[model samples]
Target: MITAKTMATGLAFAVLTGGTYAGASTPKVKPNIVFILVDDLGHGDVGFNGSTYYETPHIDQLANDGLVIKNAYMYPTCSPSRTALATGKQSFRTGVYTVPVLEKGNDQVSIFSRWTVGEEHIMYSQPLADAGYKSIHLGKWHLVGPYPKKEMEASWPLKKKLGQPKPSDFSWVPYHKEHCKAYYPEGRGYLKNIGGTYRGDPALEVGGYKSKTGGYFAPFSNPFMDQKNPKDKWLTDHLTTEAINFMDEHKEGPFFINLHYYTVHRPVVARSEELTEKYMNKLGDPKTGQGMETGKKKLTTAQYATMIESLDDNVGRIAEFLDQKGLRENTLIIFTSDNGQNIGSNLQLRGKKGYIYEAGIRVPAFVNWPGKVDARRTETPVMVTDYFPTFMELAGIDYRGQLDGQSFAPLFKGEDKALQARPIFWHLASEYRNGTCSIIRKNDMKLIQFLATGELELYDLKKDPKEENNLALKNPETAQLLLKELTGWRKANNVPLPPNSSLPY
Candidate 1:
């Protein structure tokens, strides 16, 4: 175990730096971490997930080299899932259940604590930072704003820049980019931060849409497109490059990089002309920038294929970077999405993006730690909330506060029972576009309740993984038993109130 004195004495650093790349001494195993989190990539969307329609070869490579959790989960959508991930706790516990667009300082509507990222709570990066790891976050910071247009026009941050539209799109409120400081990778305790969007960039020039960050616009537009002095790199390349540089500088010390991306999220075109042409006009016009007609046809073979292919390529780049740096053997590379895939993302999943269905909550999770972890696929049910405790245990760090998750570190070392079979709970008081209000899945037996009408449905996922069969009617007693378990689980986790935030000073 890495004790406080060991960490303070720079043992982790000395161990990390002493060995050469090709020539090894003690394997130079300091365990650099790279966490690739895609925004809105779904369960049924990739080539690995029985997707004959789309290709995600790069993402699939991690599966060949690491454990792929088939039943991995997150919250129903972006902000909520992200919140759960950062805190290792639920949204309600942080009072951050929905997408927050307003800033506490700016003329924004969403309060950080009461609406989005709870101001009263700290995040996972804090623990990593305490251990002297550099935490870096990139792309798709969506919870910050729908921003008030009037305040954005007069806001100090936005006003400092020249020739930009006022954040007037969010009614009269300004985009709440300030509250983002609390949860941003650097704010949470990263050594540095790369990319995150507080408000939509106005220069993409989609005729109908004034703001160009969220929704269906450009699939993978460069974040530095409007920069006066732009860097010559693709979005994925830039993220990977920064990661490599960080590793180079801290080759001996531990580092945590949150390599987030806005891939296959919306605007399903690739950056290359050849790839973009395949998706262009197949789904929507890139120049005109609009989505395909509803019910007319969602994802074209080319568009869907391109989206998956590009995302794969982007993920694969990180793998390639690791190989080049000779950091492949010791580093733990975890690839996961914030939530499930979105529309046109896949067909096997019933719902997309913002719903509480299996498609929205279930995600593809791959952890690649060369030579350390067995390169095999596992059906262990895991959740995003479990990562905080898992990493802490893995890095041998200490913490004074409470966390809602258990460490899956033993599983990485080829140990059993680390994927401990437990009832993972998800409580969402917010609106789901479709699907039921609440759900409980354990040991392949799932129960969903439509809270509006007090209706209940049960499915044996082992028999009907797609949730086609409803066994609640046939087994009322069994359904009641599971429902009781769900209630009990929620209470045990401190589901509603924010424990850390609610404490009296």
Candidate 2:
């Protein structure tokens, strides 16, 4: 398949060749890009997304300054969603399948390029590199698979067979205050890289911003665990400090800093015992966490509430950092999540972090770029695939071929509207190999096709926000129309046919 991420380069090439317009005055100001992606954060997790249970003051402030895509969406899992964001195309096209794929044997590693011939032009780094902007990807690299061991290729059949997760018997996260070859920030295409937990702090040497981490194992603590200071600041604080420093150093030129956070995911432990106690107290009585497997202790609605609060604080720090540096104007600060989560809060949405349901796929996205967009809400359904195109627009890059994503930049600049006729498609073929064959938002009106059972479900999102009403049989014509579009999309993208192929049967 001609992956669309690289195709967008044609757009960039054309724009660059068009050169400076005779009458156009090139703005001396070069904008910086901040792509903030959180792992497993969902529609109900933040205040903007209806999480009244906990506050999101920073996110709220961002919304005040920029437009929030009320209908922003991503795949239900990490790798595929990240792949779409990285490639601006569905996982199937890039071989991601919109779902996580695990390999127990050596026959294949699962991720498309994991088994493909040449380096799939899926990662956005190389293109951004070619664009003269410093691009960095920190935090959870769940998309490129396990860190360190997996150095993506200029070509594939990746000699580094994506490895097994290191047993997290100890603190998967440690307060290592040094950055070395193991920590290659600029080498990783990021001028700065202060990723959390799984990807240790490369900041003692490298510079960047923060937001921070967790994980689990039924037994053991690090024998060498830093007892020197039983209580060090939470890893998030360190991350933020570095991020601020990075911005301070790089504000002179155009840069892309992806400050990824590994918080609000798993292990559910606090940075310190006191904070844990504070959280436990906040949960009040505790039926809410009974029979839960949070590891350290039973959680209360309060601890969940506290964890979210801490995450919010991290957001505020980054925004405040930008304000302090006066970098808020030309910098495009985008906040989004890799997938969905159910750690806390309630927003009547069904499903959790890994399902294709709206609850799982719909994510919280707010862009705070002054003068670029208005502080309002939009119901235009945008997807992770859209970022490849959107970033190109920000960089003044033009694409020259068919792209799966339509740049929402027009909408952000006030040139478009919320409701458009374009259809967003998703294919999660890996799950079929694991169990059921499922395709979502299949029709224009939206249908779910379950190949295993030969069952189909339909809903009109306009009439039923909860997707409770079935309209497939009630309106077969609409269903068929949508199915046709979806099938064509898959076919055009070279997504395998179902069953015998990588698609569904």
Candidate 3:
């Protein structure tokens, strides 16, 4: 456990020589951490990850210059991923197995949804805050309870009037303002929060005609953000600006910023006319090319590509800021996504987001620490939960608590062979497609057990990355061993199962 005295000593050392007290012999400098989390970004979405459609030069260059984690895992959905990341525990502990509500169209809830992440949990930032790290949370902050209970109750009449209430209906008013103030990033641990709200994306419009809450371009309906875009800037650009400014303000020593960009998620909007036209002409069918990816067929391939490019461009902006400020060598940038790819992009992977398949859980993760981490690719299975311990170790703090993740800081230092072998577990107990399921991946073998139906699917991820062949029945021994381990872990964690009663659709 990192006592307050230890943290104070580390802070004193950092103040004097820009290094931390690793011990009497070994002293290490804590790097400024910039954690960039994208929403609903797919495994095959970035240029470094073999996305022929989208262009991500900055992200690709980061991967080329740093470490690319090929087998990094996250929860199948946003809330679960954020929950595990915040608490350093799996979904079983947080009860944030999936997005609170899984709605069909926009109004009808097909899945049994409940409030997931709450304020009482010990978020990673709380520890960092105690360690004297000035933290900022930019962009989406869905870890708060899905929404105020009052807002959910207010939507009933609108739901009855129109199959589903519009995005505008729930975005603002008296209640939402109160809710945002009560459960936003500042209420959590961030000293400053811009564009951080309860919902995934406030860009939702009410009409079934559009898929997003609101368009990606401002004027955004986000209550937490100011409508100060006179030039009608893109949301990603605005967020990048805020993050760069925050870094500049806190360029003294060690700091942590969670820049969760709300781009490339959904309600896929076109970028500037120039970039949109470039992608459209580059990838769109000449004769079949219509408008952006929102009409008739809603072929948003070109729009999605543009969104990625914009995200990459903003990343370049951050990189430039770090370099120009001479902070690149001391800043550690960790780039990843909340969940997996959205539909229409990840065809090669088994399933899209919101499933137990690799496509839904496997995400692109890259860590860059100049003068420390080297450029390489690792197939070691690392979960988002591991980031908590890894960052704590980097800050020269010993975090002792009930944590489900092990620090991969040793792997970052090129001691790749030193990492201890362990099984990474995932529990998605919500009313999605196949009901509730639990997964455990040990080494190259993975076993998935379905709750609704007593079924098991085993796959050798090394041999079949696509999970095409299930060797559960064929290799009973391997399957049984995996099941025993998974069940034992579940029993230990007290992971919840779906209720016996039929779910309300």
The residue pairs that clash in candidate 1, if any, are: 41-341, 42-340, 42-341, 101-145, 103-176, 107-174, 148-173, 148-174, 149-167, 149-168
lDDT of 2 by residue, 1-505 (tens): 1235544553563354332111112245557888888767777667676554455787877876688887788877666776677656556556655322342223232323232211333345545565677665555554433333333333443322343234342222332223222333333345444342232212211111121223211111222222222232554454455566677777775777777665665545455556556655442222222223344444544455555667788878878877888888888889998777756533456566766667778888988888777888877777787777777667765445334676787777553643255677777654522323345452236677653454677887767766778888999997777666666665555555334333342
lDDT of 2 at 56: 75
- Rank by lDDT, descending? 3, 1, 2
TM-score of 1: 0.75
Supply every candidate's count of residue pairs whose N, Cα or C atoms clash at under 3 angstroms.
10, 21, 8
Over 4 Å off, model 2: 1-28, 98-118, 146-163, 168-188, 196-232, 271-300, 345-347, 400-403, 415-419, 432-444, 498-505
Q: Which candidate is the best by lDDT?
A: 3
lDDT of each: 0.59, 0.56, 0.72
- Return the lDDT, model 1, position 475: 84
Per-candidate TM-scores read: 0.75, 0.75, 0.84
**Which candidate should be chosen as best, given TM-score against the real structure?**
3
Task: Say what the RMSD of model 3 is.
Answer: 7.2
lDDT of 3 by residue, 1-505 (tens): 1345544543553454332223112126667999999998988888788775678899999988998998888988887898899777777666666675552222232223444354444567766776677889998887665345653455321232112245556534455466555466675567888877666765645552274434576666666776655243678888898888889999986789899998877777777567766765664322222222455334466666778888999999999999999999989999999888874455556887887888889999999888788898888888988888787777776554545676777777564553436888987666555557788999899999876665899999889988999999999999999999998877765666655413221
C-alpha lDDT of residue 184 in model 3? 61
Model with the higher TM-score, candidate 1 or 2: 1
In terms of lDDT, the poorest run of 10 residues in model 1 is 19-28
Error of 2 at 97 (Å): 2.8
